[model samples]
Target: MSDGVATVHLVRSPARTVWTAIALSGAFLLAGCGSQADLAKVNHPRTVVPAKVVQKPQPNTPPRPVEPVFAPERLRAVDPCALMDTQTLSAFGVPASSRAVALSDCGNYMKDGAGKRLSITLRLGQNVLISDTAKTTKLAGLTTVESTSTTTCFVKSVVQEGSVVLGIVAQVDYEGDSCDVGRRLNESAINRIRTNAPLRPQGNKGSLTSVDPCAIFSPVTATEVLGGTPSMTPYDLYRCNWRRDSLSFGIEFAENTDPKNSSANKKAEVVTIEGVTAYQRKDDSFGNSCKIEWLHKATTDGKGEVATVSVDNTKKGVDIDLCAKATTVAKALVPKLPKP
Candidate 1:
């Protein structure tokens, strides 16, 4: 799905995993911890390379004449976590999670409980105009191209005046109906876009969309969770990591990233706190770490506010309670998010 340009699949723990390419190229985003994109052979070389989102959204702006009403470049400046909303992905089981976004692409590494993983990537592009003469059936007025593998299904649908392409992928980690899973996501995204709404509602000061992810966590909170003074890992605005050796932990905030893509296909459950919703994404991808993503606060742009509290015990030596601990930190976070 967006692994830099493709979503990389990790068969190892978050710390030792390598981000081997799966699909798309806006490169996607880094998986696990600190690793770059590495080339891996894939069956489909025809997959589209994702582009970047907008540089920023200037509120009350006029639509560009030459570009599509909703410019994919506009996504570059926006939050990748906001691309797909939770409502669109609920069919996948887990309703909330995190993601890495780019100007024209977004994606997540989704693992089912059985040790199978499906990496889904979304890409935005423009293509030639189409007529009813096309072979594919018209769904929500967009032209679509769909393909399927033994365990994966891909659908590339046209949105925004029938020229903007929305490329979506659903891969099963251990062999399920990835095609059906993907089709659901693909259809939901198209329906939402048709609403033609702005990304975020205007003048909501409680919104965490622009807050520095590092600032969201305090040292006191860090001590309460990871047992050490926390330091920034200097990755990106949406992600924050503690640099100390006591334990590797941090809060990763995503504007539009949907947890449904990152949540476990099975054994993933929905938990509500203070009337706010989030997903506890537990994956054996790395036996030593776990992620708890709060899929709370819906964005005006059709995505939602997601906060992922994660832990990596690869270096900590101590085997701690990942979910109980993550939920503990999440409790402190719900109060800080945007609310009605």
Candidate 2:
């Protein structure tokens, strides 16, 4: 050993060796814990910054109000001639051929205050077949016109195969010099004629009234005596066909007859102007007089079988007096047969 220096020797034992290792680990663990605590404290003292706010951009102005694209005035001014031509061609069922003729233009037609126009055209075949073309400016007032002016053109070739007679007549009227208005009027008139023409029959064979005077006779001109337009009212005339074997009977009366006043009732009476004998009978139920007529004829021509009755009306035309004055003039006038 050297002077002032001490030399210590460590003895190796199992227990002491283990204890020494544990102490070294504990010290290292304590140092690590101390470092984590100091770091946490230091971070807690620092201030935190808030995130920035970003705003969305606003639209500069509200969207402008949308306007309707179509106006009624603009529609009214649109050229209708093209539309008319298209419709007419469609109706003809054929392409515009040289044989087809254009009678009038839109210029000569008239326009109403609403700027509506009318135009007309007529096409005919070799057999007098007629086809009418009407062009209208306004769709609303097409049916207002009574008549129209139409152009007539004859087709060199026959379009249809049938026995038909076609004739067209047109009358055009205009407020001004617009052909468009005239065309529309013509179209309306033609359409009406076409609809109404089909209703008229050439003969009265299947109709309610008899056309042959020998088959039937009108006691009086029912149409004239009735005194009203047939088109406006329901009053109509019908001929009663005569049958020698069957008895012909009818009931007639005044329109407004009052039974309380016999004089008024007498004034309003129905008389047979021709064909048969008539008489008035008082009906107790309605206090009215009912006029009835019956004709029984054995002869075929009804020469001696005819009778005439007259009805006289009061000054006011309210009361009528029906009298049955039978005359044998028809019988006397009938030709006598030669001795057998």
Candidate 3:
């Protein structure tokens, strides 16, 4: 949405002179047959061709649709750190640190004069659930949902509302009334996104943000694994859920420690998936489920860009090997992911 406007502004500024110069240059020409000779004038009438006029579309003439400010495809390229930088946060407190918490999130930490901690988190494609107590207001020409707890405040503005709903969220945690701080941060974040927000590096060949989680697993693959046709639902751009009667499958791409070395796993069973070393674990504590995880690549600071697949048959009465089912889905998924 913002890119289209930038392009139009660029063309309008310098393109007018180019077209006008072409038209005027063709209308007249100087010719001299000899030194100190008088200029020759054609007796015949000369026609001057005017530059083509570019007209802006009128309101009543099938108005051009305004694209959503933040759509899924566009959000994938947004850099979270650029949305809320040190300069943008300097007003609240001394900007202490800023780091990327996730692909779509950046967390900023600061300290007030009294040495109290203050934080603001900016996220793209944030999933926000509006409760009855939450109030709605307009921020940057978009409907914003505001809610607060004792120490934290949440402000969310929907960027795209439809089957796959998405929003931009600004959360603040402060010692004082966080709502006031949240309001200012939210407004600044929105304005930056609409105007001069930075973007991810172009042509990131193997970035998972460009992949669609829903397209990774097909309906036929779900049916073959679950023994019944499954309904596919995407939680966000990075996660998808497929459910049958008593069986379910899920896949997600997110940040984590190396699955083989993660302490959360009771025992990491070494396994190989599509030539990639992986780990599988069975967890009966929560339900009859098994998970298979592998490191897609190292992102930053010992964090692994990982893909995890889970199979749950807790609802089924019979003793079905959940690990085998998880392996099947993992095999189908690993081959499709782009190599880092």
The lDDT leader among the candidates is: 3
Deviation in Å, model 1, residue 74 alpha carbon: 16
Model 1 TM: 0.42
Question: In candidate 2, how many Å is residue 305 off?
Answer: 22
Per residue, candidate 3 scores C-alpha lDDT tens digits across 1-340 of 0111101110111121000010000000011111111112222222322212111222234311124546566566666666455555666667766777766667777876577888777666654444434446666666566666668777666565444344566777888756666666666666655655456767666767666677767678889898766766554456676777667778877766877678865577989999999888887664577888888988776787788887776453679888898899989988889988
Report clash pairs, candidate 3: none
| Model 3 stretches with alpha carbons more than 4 Å out | 1-67, 203-205
Full candidate order by TM-score, most accurate first: 3, 1, 2
Off by over 4 Å in 1: 1-201, 204-206, 255-265, 299-303, 315-317
Q: lDDT value for candidate 3?
A: 0.60
Model 2: how far residue 320 lies from native, Å: 8.8
Worst 10 residues of 2 by lDDT: 18-27
Decoy 2 TM-score against native: 0.17
Task: After the best TM-score superposition of candidate 1, give how far the Cα of residue 142 lies from its true spot, in angstroms.
Answer: 39
Best by TM-score, which number?
3
Per-residue CA lDDT of model 2 for 20-76, tens digit only, reads 000000000111112111111111121222212111111233211111211112111
